[model samples]
Target: MYGRMNNNIYILLFCIVFLISIITFTTIRIITDKEREFKKLPNLKAWKYISILIIVAITSFYGVEIYKSATNYGGKLAWFIERLKNERSVKFEHNNIYEFGVEGIFEDINKEHPLPKKLYMASDFDLTFNSDGIITAFDTFVYGKNAHGKEETYLIAYDKKKSQDITIIRNGYANPDYDDDKLVEPLIKTVNAIPVKQTVSKWNESKYGLVYYGKRNWGYNTEGIININEDGKEHNLEKSTSEIIGYTVSIFVPGKEKEVVPARYNLIGDPNWSKANTNPNQKSSKEKQQDLTNSKEQFYLSKEVGYKLNITDKALGSTFYSLSKTIDGGKTWEVINNDPFNGTIGSASGITFLNDKLGFLVAVRPSGTEGELYRTDDGGISFKKVNYTPREVKLDSGQSISPFDSPGMPYEKDGVFNMLVGQGSDGDYNGNSSALYQSKDKGETWEYVKEVKSS
Candidate 1:
């Protein structure tokens, strides 16, 4: 399929080049003819007509390609076109108004907007609030086409306090792509009388909630306070036109303006913020290692000894994990084996140890409906695939089925090791059930127990 698509792209490119060459050739001939005899050429009119047709053909081909790439089979285009037709479309509006409250501000700023015609996604909204928990300013983008039909963003800033009607403080193509490098020092350098908090509004009901940085109590200084000296000249945050400031976001419910809590904050001098400035849009090595350590699957045999499986790499729908042993209560860890499943491709579902010398590891395939079970007896130094005994269970239609799809980690219950092999997402009987297995000789082999139904 992809090869055919690549061939089509090559054909399109050739057609574009051919059409452009004709256009260029005709244009140069028409311009360079000193005696103007080019206009009297026998096929001059015919060539002109052919040039127009070629231009239209090229345009139509480009339009078709753009549509296919943007809509991915016409699923997104209809709704987006409808949004563009609406009068209140956020796409063209320069200013927006909301009620004088937190919920209203949040709803208006974070409301769903039409997919941008040119940009990657919808416009982002930033809100600024005063110390009294009142939203004082906000900024959002309006998109429109230039004379050339190329879309561009109009970044607008508004002030809410100057009037019940929102006041437009600034509007321009100053930061069309919202690139931080284009920021300039504001011309009006007034210290905000009221302490302010700035936050990016939550969009699309994000599960992660609103994102902000800074000290909750420090509050953001509207004027740049931090200063940097370079080349015998001192530049402060405000002087350099740095928008960076520590600010806190407040959480509030409707009709309860007085009941607000400082939910999250980002401070300028905070350790994370400083690291971000040094690294700029990427995690530091230490931070990445810490994240990997935090996500590691661990099985502890005692307070002082444990085993952990850390994901090392993932490629082509397969995840690789590195097994490590930790002594002295996880103070330090040494990698025991890099390939626990011997190059098997899947996700590490669970890892557990029965003793200092016996352990089990479960890996689920990318399909989620199948997995592999492995056992290690030499303290996780090596592992070998273990097979569970499959059992047949009667379905709702009185049909007997054996589901050996997903195998879970082994756990000791009532002095016996029990494991559950699940049917995963492909189960049609008992709503994707599991088959329980038991091991009496410490996870070396398994015996069929019974089918467990999904709750």
Candidate 2:
């Protein structure tokens, strides 16, 4: 870039010099011709002086132009040019630039696991491939919320050796539980190398609780420089960073609609159905379901999957919520569960699904019991309670809240789930959460990714 700028400066100076020479010569010739016509050399010296003055003025004008051009070319233009050049280089050898055949591997993955038809499945992957162009693993960051309804980050790792994928929530760089058949050491190193914490930090910084860095928005935090080797040694990567003011989303266009749509949202309040459930005589099951459904009737439609949640008082005055998903728009809904509590001594708070069959639910008791997590593999036919402890929501006022309320529905992208856990007095869906948790094993187990402050 500097070299090109220098060349331009030289060319501009040459043009200025050439123009000045012509102007000076023209002025002198005019004066001389007038003198010859008059047949007298009257004030020839003064005319010469005038010609010199004219040349000086012309030179000064061109000199200013040259300086201005240099300034623009070096300041804004230079940065733009360098960025463009780098981008072009990346595009030209995009497949091999990041790593040999990185693009090809992505293309293959997309072709092999095309987005699910009749379902809004935006399959966006954050991937790291081996040197041989074999995809070793990938990650998906959830901006909105997970099955548990908290906005957090989850990780789904693919081990080539095992030919299987496993999800896990990060606990401050702690390694996830790997299956016995897979090699844990390499997968651990790869997961650790990814800037999962940094990505979550960006999401927390966003007012809308999101971090999507890619080629969709005019190079806004799109590209990076990194090295990949077999040793698993830490490589310093220079990433382009952006301070996104709010959460923005675009479904990885494929299955149904080839468009990137922003995730629509609404805030939920304290369980109003508590009274209806507490007094079964007050409201019938249908009435209670309608009430719960009416409150959360608004749904956000991604590519193929549409998510809607209803919190109602169904059992013993406890909170009962159902997570309904529609694959064919609003025409039909395949719910994970009709009654989230299911005789358990807790209230359903949040829900999220990684796919059709695998899903998760969050529940808490009104009697100050710790939050409990449940998972279902057969599309919510039945859920098994998982033994997991949750972190308490520490308020700014030095008070603590438990059984995290998922104001924002849990967001699931790829195979990862993100949820925010917090308690608020206002009873509205505000992101004033104490912590964010990520789960890869369909919410069966979650690890603390980070603490998120209310935005």
Model 1, stretches more than 4 Å misplaced?
1-296, 394-400
For candidate 2, which ten residues in a row score worst on lDDT? 265-274
Report the alpha-carbon TM-score of model 1 versus the true structure.
0.38
Which ranges of candidate 2 are over 4 A from the true structure? 1-316, 319-328, 332-338, 345-348, 364-372, 392-409, 412-416, 424-433
- lDDT for every model? 0.50, 0.40
For residues 12-73, write the lDDT of model 1, one tens digit per residue.
78979988997998788777883575547865789889989988998897777666644412
| Candidate 1 local lDDT, residue 193 | 14
Q: Who wins the TM-score comparison?
A: 1
